[model samples]
Structures are given as C-alpha cells and as structure tokens.
Target: MEFADRVILVTGASSGLGRHAARALALAGATVVLLGRHEKRLDGVYDDILAAGGAQPVIMPFDLAEADDPRFNALAATLAHQLGRLDGILHSAAQFIKLSKLEHQRLKHWEAAFATNLMAPFALTRACLPLLEGAEDAAVLFSAEEHGLNPGPYWGGFGLSQAALIALAELFAAEHQDNPNLRFNVLIPGPVSSPMRHRTHPGEVPENLPKPESLLPFYLTWLGPQSRGRSGEVIRPDLGYDPSRQD
Candidate 1:
C-alpha cells in the first residue's frame, strides 16, 4: 500500500528490522523519521533512503533507555513543529543483553531491558498521542517475540518485557477503541535472521531464517491504511497469517 503524504516514525532505525522497515516505508512514499541512539548508523539509513529517491527522512538521535517523559514529549513537539502530524509509530527498538535464569539475572540487566523494550515505547506513544490524533488514520505497532507469548526457561527480563509489550498494545487499543483515527497492534517477526536473533539463537543457522526484509508486506499492511479498524490483534507473519482476512 502507498503511504503518500504520511509521516511515520520508526525506533531502532539504525539497523536490522527497523532499518529495513524504514527504507521500505520511505520507498512506499512515506516521509520517515528515523530514531536511534547511533547517530552514525542513523545517518547511513537516512542517506540510503535519500539515494533510493525516497522521501527525505528526518534523523532523530535519542537514546531510548536514558530518555524520560519530558524528553519524549519534547521529541513529539519537535515532530509536530516539523511534520505537523504523525501517521504511525513503529516500536522496533529492543534490548536483550543475555539469556539467563531469573535468579541469575542482574538487577541492572532487568532495568535496562525493561527501559528499552517497554518503558520507551509506552512513553513515546503517550507523548505522540496528540500528533497521532491529528491524522485521519494513525497506527502504533509494537514488536513482539515468540518467547514473550510462550515464556520458557532462561528467557529472563527480555522475555518479560516483550510479554508486557503485548499488554501495552492491547491496553492502547482498548483505550482508543472508540477513536476511529487511531489503532494499536502487536507484530511478532519470528525467526528473522537479524543481529538480535543471531545473538539470542547463536546455534541456529542464519540461512535458515527469513530475511528481515521478508516482513515488509506485513509491516506495510499493519502500518498503512490497509489495516484500518483492525486493532488489539497480535500479527504473526511467520505463521502465514493473512492480516487482510478479518475472519
């Protein structure tokens, strides 16, 4: 689907799925706002999008883990001053330091994981609500994981944060159910051959997993107008699920 005139923000835009999604969204005619901590990587993605003839993207360099509510609010204000309105926000940023049993996990590790995977998305979305509401259609998508839904041994704080994201998505959807302009949903990009997956499942063969770009169709369907009126749902592209099918 085309996103002509739409302005979308993507966290973790420096690399992996976030990078791929940003490029694809830009190519689809959306003006992208690239958010990430790494200024160098963000610039690379920005340049790639420009070279590909995509809309000139805005690079927002902010560390999600260290940002507070005021910082997020300020970001929203900046976006409003620049783009006027926000059509979508894709929460693709995540942190997984390591896999450890609950008893073995350090307090700092748990805090860091929660801050990036849960708190940042929640805070950013809350701050951007006003901008999102200004659009005719807006979407907030949270990146989920298989371990989050089906918790298993040694998943640790990373898994817990992901599980919380599902709840966060559902809560946002419920809160905005009456507001036809906004929607929220969770997406699980299962077994993608990305750095996170490589780190989490080092034993798995990289070639066996789907490429990050493979999720573009699903991403477009959910973030664009195609999935309008569809919210509070958990989408699993790896399951061959068709989001267009309401049934």
Candidate 2:
C-alpha cells in the first residue's frame, strides 16, 4: 500500500500504458480516479481494480477534446472539495488514429489530437495546480514518444501531438522546479502490445512484443513517493530497467 491514503488521477485509464499505471497505483492503495471517454470501458477497468483487491477507483467519463476549461476546473475543484488535495496525476490519454502524411491528414483529426493530447493536459494540469501543490509530495507525469525517433509521413497527427506534449512537459518542468513538492516528468512506453500498438503495426507479431503489464515497476516507482525529487526526467522503462526482470 505504498500510495495508501493518497489520491491519484489517471487519464486514458481504459487501456494501454494508462491502464497499467492506474492499476499499479491502485494496487498500491491509492484512491485512483479514472478519466476516460467511455464509461463502460472505464467501469471495466474499475472492476479489474476491485477484483485485484486494489483500492476502488472512481471513474470520470470525459471527452477532453470537447470538454471546456471549466469542465476540467470543476473536476479538480470537486476533488479539492471532497479529497482535500490531489497527490498525483498522469496525463496518459492519447489519440493514435491514422498516421497519414501531413498533406493527407484530416484537419479534424489533427485538431482533436492536439486538443486531447496537448491542450487538455495543459488545462487539467493548470486547473489542478493549486491542489497538487498542497500535497506533501505531488507528481504530474505526461506521456511522450521515444526521443530521437523521427516520425515519418505516416506518423502525422500522432507524431505532432507527441512532440507537442513533450514540449509542454519541458515547459511545465522549467516553470515548476523551484516549487518544493511538485515533480513533472514525461514517460515513453515503447512498443507495448496494446490495442493502439495493434492499430499502428498490424503486421507485426504480437507475441514478440512486451505486454503492457510489464511496465509495472517503473509505473510504481514513478507514481509513488519514491519519485518525489524526479522532475523533468524523460523516463523509459525500456531504457532504465528491463521490464522482463525489474530490479
């Protein structure tokens, strides 16, 4: 129960990297709040946590692309009013649809991707800033693509969104460094065998890829109090430790 008594909110809690992180934190006894667009899927994940005997998580169904700034503020304010403060938040939600060439990419997809992946994180983080600062040790982690990987013509919207999120992470880290209890970091979950991965690389054999659950150790470390001093770090379970045998 590493996170016992603390509150943690995770976006994209329905699947992939977000699911792993949320599950890991919940299992460690955090009162996880799952935020996603699909209530049914979110409920399924919430049930998984309950079945695992993890702290029961609350689900907040929201479509970040369509939600206004007040929606995010209301969520945070509600948490503050009810829970007193937010101990952690993970911006793991993303839209990884078509990887069209820049010229071929639909403007709608690009805009929605940016809205959900970049703008939403900024809005939600800003809304929760005060509450986060109130925590004895607070963390705000965002997801990023692997560094040094040049996205090709087929990686348009998703690639651009990833770049934007990385930039946002850097900006937040730079601005918040002097704050004692706030830590912000970007994480890269590379090639995990997930629905998004299957959508991206349909021809690849799924058996050769690592499972999403393999990232638990990194998830636990980054989400818990152990990562209090780790800010602005670009974390990668694939690089820092072997997911197959975490130590």
Candidate 3:
C-alpha cells in the first residue's frame, strides 16, 4: 500500500495506457478515479480493481472531447464531496488525431484536437487546481510526446496540440513551482504499443514496442512522492534517455 490514503485521477481510463495506469496505481493502494467516455468499460476496470483487492475505484464517465466548463465545475464539486482533496492528476487521456498536412486539415479536425489533446487538460487542470491546493503534497502530470525537438509537417492536429500541451506544462510549472505543496511536469511515454500508437503508425508490428504495463514504473515514480523535488522536467520513460549516459 504505497499510496494507501492518496487519491489520484486518471482520465481516458477505459483502455490503452490510461487503463494500465489506473490498475497500476490502484494496486499500489491509491484511490484511483477512472474517467472516460465509455461507462461500461470504465465500470469493468473499476470492478476488476475491486476484485483484485485494491481500493474500490471511482468511475467518472466523461468524454474529453465534449468537456465544458460546467462539466469541470460539477466534477470538482463531486470530487470535493467524495474525496475532499486530490493528491494527483494524470492527463493521460488523449485523442490521437492522425497524420495530415496542415493545408489538407479540416477545421473540425483541428477543433477536435484542441478539445481532446489540449483544452480537456487545460479545463480539468484549472477546475482541479483548487482541490489540488487542498492537498498536503500533490502532482500534476501531463502525458506528452516528443515535440518541438523533432517538428514535422504530417503530425498536423495532434502534433500542434501536443506542442501547445508541452508549453502548457511549463506555463503551469512556472506559475506553481513557488508553492511548496504542488509540482507540475510533462511525462513523455515515448513509443509504446497502444491503440493511439497504432493509429499514428499503422504499419508497425505491435510487438516491437513496449507494452503499456512496462511504462507503469516510470508513471509510479512521477505520481508518487518519490519525485517530489522535481518539477518542469520532461521525463522520458526510455532508460536510454538518461542524461548521465549522454556522451
């Protein structure tokens, strides 16, 4: 029970990395809040967590693509009443808008990207900010990908939103680093075998990439108190990415 009394919110927990992360966090003894659009799938994950003798998780069925201000306010109230405070939040919920040139992209596609890839996190993070402030120690972790360093044209919507998301992490980190109670950072999971990954690279054989479960150790490190002194750093799950190993 590493996080026995802690509460953590994981969005897009129906499947993919979010599902794995929810299970991993629950097994470590945190009260996991599973948020996703699919109520049935979310319920199944919650049931499995309880069946495994972990904490009875909370299921919050919400479509990140459709999240609005009222939804956030209501969610905040609900969490405030149920848990009182949130120890962590993982914006692992992302819509992998596929490769398309900027000129060929539709306005709706771009809107959807901002909604799922960017605005959802912005709204949820803002709404949860007050509840997070109530925590003795907390972390806000964003699921980011390699961007800015390797910019290219084909990544259109998702790529552009991710660039914005990464910047948002730093923006929040800069604003909140002065506070001793909270920390903010971006977590880049690299190339993992996920539905989103397949969508992004449909030609690749799935077995070649690391499974979602394999990434949990790094996720645990950030979500837990172990990474307390760290903020604003972009954590790469690849061990080969170690700064000490840089030649």
The best candidate in terms of lDDT: 1
Error of 1 at 210 (Å): 0.5
| TM-score of candidate 1 on Cα atoms, chains taken together | 0.95
- lDDT score for residue 226 of model 2: 86
Task: Compose the digit string of candidate 2's lDDT tens values, residues 1-247.
Answer: 8899999999999988898889889989999999999999999999999998899898889898887888989999889887787998988888775766677878888888889888999999999999998899998988777621355567887787888788888899899999868999887878787888888777677666788778778777777788888788888676333335422
Deviation (Å) of 110 in candidate 3: 0.7
Off by over 4 Å in 3: 239-247
Residues 113-207, candidate 1, lDDT per residue (tens digit)? 99999999999999999999989999999998988898778998888899998999999999999998899999999878788988998877777
lDDT against the true structure, each candidate: 0.91, 0.84, 0.86
Ordering by lDDT: 1, 3, 2
Stretches of candidate 1 off by over 4 Å are 239-247
| C-alpha lDDT of candidate 3 relative to the true structure | 0.86
Error of 1 at 43 (Å): 0.7
Model 3 TM-score relative to the real fold: 0.94
Specify the poorest-scoring 10-residue window by lDDT in model 1: 238-247
Q: How many steric overlaps does candidate 3 have?
A: 0
Pairs of residues clashing in candidate 3: none
